[model samples]
Target: MPANLTADFLKARNEFRAAKDRHDKLVALEKMLATIPKHKGTDHMQADIKRRIAKLKEETQGKSSHRKGPQLDHIEREGAGQVVLLGPPNSGKSSLLAALTNAHPEVAEYPYSTVLPLPGMMRFEDVPIQLVDLPPMSAEYSESWLYSLVRHADLCLLTLDGSLQAEELANTVEEIILLLEEHHIRLVRRKEITEEEMRVRDVPCRIVLTRGDLGDLASRVEELSDLFPVIVTSPIDRTGLDALREGVFVALDVIRVYTKLPGKPADMVEPYVLPVGSTALDAVRMVHRDFVDRLKYIRVWGSGRFDGQQVPSTHLLADRDIIEIHLS
Candidate 1:
């Protein structure tokens, strides 16, 4: 059986996932239960929702009975996905984050200007991705948070100084790679395998050539393409800003799926974020587990569809595809 789910249910799920407080989570769960389809297909999902609601209520009561000390935690990931900017000192990482987001990371020409993680939200079309600017990665210096930040990130934007001479750029990048390797991390193209290590973590990364507005720097950095896939940008001139936005979205391997009522149009305002190659059944399950057993089929209204064409539950979905689910 397939899960025939609705967009409203998915939105509530996101709210639950993103909620910072127990009260907010409880509110989101209640909305999720209300939005969930009342059908046999959703029986399991209904139970799961109720279970979560009960758990949250219990936790709320427990919280009122206990007081906790201040706790140190990593920057909470927000938006569609979390991405980090990593590079050597003076690599223009802060400038790039500042340009793309509202975050005021202290941009300076000298090294080690940023002392802590600075996070901001960047938008691609209507989708928001969390971008974090961390202290630079270098042979002599890197914050303790660098490893965890890169490891947990959905993608890493390797910011490089376009103004650096070719040889200097090569050395800087090589050192950065070695530093990552020491921490059991490796950067590679999606298909490339990491050299054997007890706990090697391979991260998907792309190069962002910053300061290209400087004399002939953009062209010089083009010579490094054999080194890695590169996106050139200049915060001063706003060059390649659009390309950077689109590149990050694609590199993250994410897609958005929209849902619709049987006879009404799909809700275009909000979408369910899923990885690429996600199927109709996968989407249904994400919307709510109960949709799994009762989902009869799905009708898609985008990309290769002839307007609301019926598709198998296993049909692969693309970004912006409008899906209408039927029940048994």
Candidate 2:
């Protein structure tokens, strides 16, 4: 098989060749690693890039021995799931983050206003999901660490400026997609594991068209909806913000399972979040490892045929279902 290098990879390679300092070389190398195609043909190239990155990191750390501060390369996951925002500059990422989450990231009319990742918790009913606002993705401005954050995110929201004309908006979306692909991140609607796709991270994504109040977005929304679940929102008037929150929760594909004692009322607050299709046995294991072996059966509510109906350990749980573990 041929390596089949992409134009983006070649450009990054050239940047690496032209780099004057270790920092620039490291940045370029990160880009190269991200943009390089993932396949049997490029396996050797990938390994080489990894080796170079490891070496550059050691050198950079050695030179900055006194460097002290929080690490910017990673964000800790919180809430039920972590969702990272990605888009072109001035695409209303900060505005949307401020509107949807408690974090007050700087919202400016100028491009490149955001330089670091800021995270806030967004609540969808009783469940809270972590929403991270990342620096914009562009050829000249995006940081290499942003790609790493996206690769690890539980979900991705690709925001577009709804104020642009449909054609320009579409073009901006295309550019963002190309940049993400160059970095080996694939935005998918669902997790359909396959041999080829497994090589790269397939994070679920939702499209958010911000600045909905600025222009007519019906056409843009309709067109983009064909690609992914689309939500048109505006921080100015808070349009579609509610729907966006709900969409994020649904895109996570997780369910909230409540627990209760046999004689006590169900604990409605702080439900245990689990992936859809999880079983009662899984919940038992989460509660405690001891329960896994000592558990006799589970009584279910909400999804059960009747209230307090006894179910086997393997019984599947649904969202908002209440379970009471009965021990022998």
Candidate 3:
């Protein structure tokens, strides 16, 4: 018989796959074990999960005693989602990060100034999105762990120097794509994944034309706009920063849902972030997994025919929707 995995189990498994830090991975594994169907078919899987959890616990204890230099291999994700900036040396990754986020990466006139990943929270209206500025991706100073960062990113921003001629900029972009492809990472503009491309990781990407004030980039932007969403930005003049933030949020494809008690006012601040098309059931699960079983129904203030209209658990949510959960 097949293992007959459940939706909750599959969601936990995906979390495990996407987890970079050991603590997050262990939590996901525990959830997987908890949600997986208990049957003869899943006996081996259960045993494997148990063994991995044991090993992780051992490693976690050992790490406290024999900690070495700071490991930059993994960055704990923060805010809504992680967006990694990639490009050749002096492609303005550092400058862009400094301008957009609070991160103070060393922005210099020379190449290879950034040696590690620097992350900062960039607030877009009400949401805080993480922006990580990594070391430049070039033959001269690319880090081996850069591929892992890009592979796990929610969205990748390919920064290109707008001052370079259109042909040179295009060649640089091609080289960057080829280098990532060698590591089994295919950059795509869309979020949809297909079965045939399961072997390679498809990371959604956007093109950022930096140094927009330096040269006439109309033709350059026109050329690359056909392939990817192009955002021409100049950190000096603060041009296109707002548009970039909006674009990044759109690329992440998430919705914010506000929660309210049955008789209380809605908490407008810090809306719970969920992926697009997430249902009322998903929101309840996010609010508290224990509420799933006790969930009676939901009432919606937005995205409903009438205010405070009763909605079923399967009701799809929209951006800025206010939901009040009714539990048994």
Candidate 4:
């Protein structure tokens, strides 16, 4: 027998939620509304979904003056996330990018080979995540634009050469942290609550040990644990590629949702990785204000009690769901 209506609904709902294309969300929303079963089992769900669909359409018609700006462009997920790679000269950022992604950045055994930022997409399970290699900075002084880029990134991957001693490595981390703090981009330890906590706030991060084969890499990672989470990887040894890929996704704060529909085959959609504090309204906003209006009912499938279960618009979403939304 085919999957139940709730299963199909959740699948499509998640697809729409994770959709990068605005129009694709509308299509998914329409399919969800059409395929969901009618009657008491889904009555309230159908009504609310319809209401949202209408609201989304009206909002798109320029009804709300509160929604106007360049921010619309910001409401997008072209890649996993905008992550900038930062560190001093010869920190192995460019080398790591060249190995992880197909970008052939200058990879000489020298300092400052990269004078400008080079962008490349690293695909994890076919989901393309952006990684930008920024120009190297020094502890004594950092360029203004370099600081700005790191500040704006959804996550920053700071590479530390394993060859540096414990004290030097700590100093380098402290310096970069200070630079980040100077620009109001502080890394918080979500695990700890303190006057100056190091939680993964709006922006999450991970330390990558480049040149992992070097003798001191492990020791340095151990020392840095007091500061931030670490991902020990070597583009040369290729020892931690898998872990690094997962780290990129985690730092991006995304979740994957598959799509299933009536009389349709299921497919894996892009990762709908929002920030830590994303809400259903935030998820809807990810699509467009129009869809938020027309959001009727979202039926979910896969994992947990909600698996193959239908819920109202106010329902929260889970990870790796097959969601379908029924709209008006």
Maximum-TM-score candidate: 3
Q: After superposition on all CA atoms, what RMSD does each candidate show versus the true structure?
A: 9.8, 10.1, 4.2, 12.6
Worst 10 residues of 4 by lDDT: 191-200
* Model 3 lDDT tens row, 165-242: 888888888888889999889989987744323346798999999998786789999888777889999999988999
Which residue pairs show backbone clashes in model 1? 3-291, 3-292, 41-290, 41-294, 42-290, 45-290
Query: Which scores greater on TM-score, model 2 or model 3?
Result: 3
Largest lDDT belongs to which candidate? 3
Q: Per-residue lDDT of 1-328 in model 1, one digit per residue for the tens?
A: 4455688987787677556577988999899899988887677777868987897797678753453642112567787888889998888999999999989988887889988888999999889999999887887877776687887677888898888888888788788888888887888756242113114667888889888787666555666677678888999999999999999999888789899998787888878888777788878887877999998888888854587898988789898888888878
Query: TM-score per candidate, in order?
Result: 0.75, 0.79, 0.85, 0.69
Error of 2 at 41 (Å): 14
lDDT of 4 at 277: 41
- Candidate 3's C-alpha runs over 4 A off are 1-67, 196-198
Residues 1-328, candidate 2: write the lDDT tens digits.
8777898987787567445467988999999999999999888778878987997898678865555886676686788888998998889999989988889999999999999999999999999999999999976778988898998788999988887787777777778777888888888888664434425668888889988888778998877777787899988999899999999999998999999998999999898888787788878866776988788889999888998999988789999999999877
lDDT by candidate, in order shown: 0.81, 0.85, 0.87, 0.68
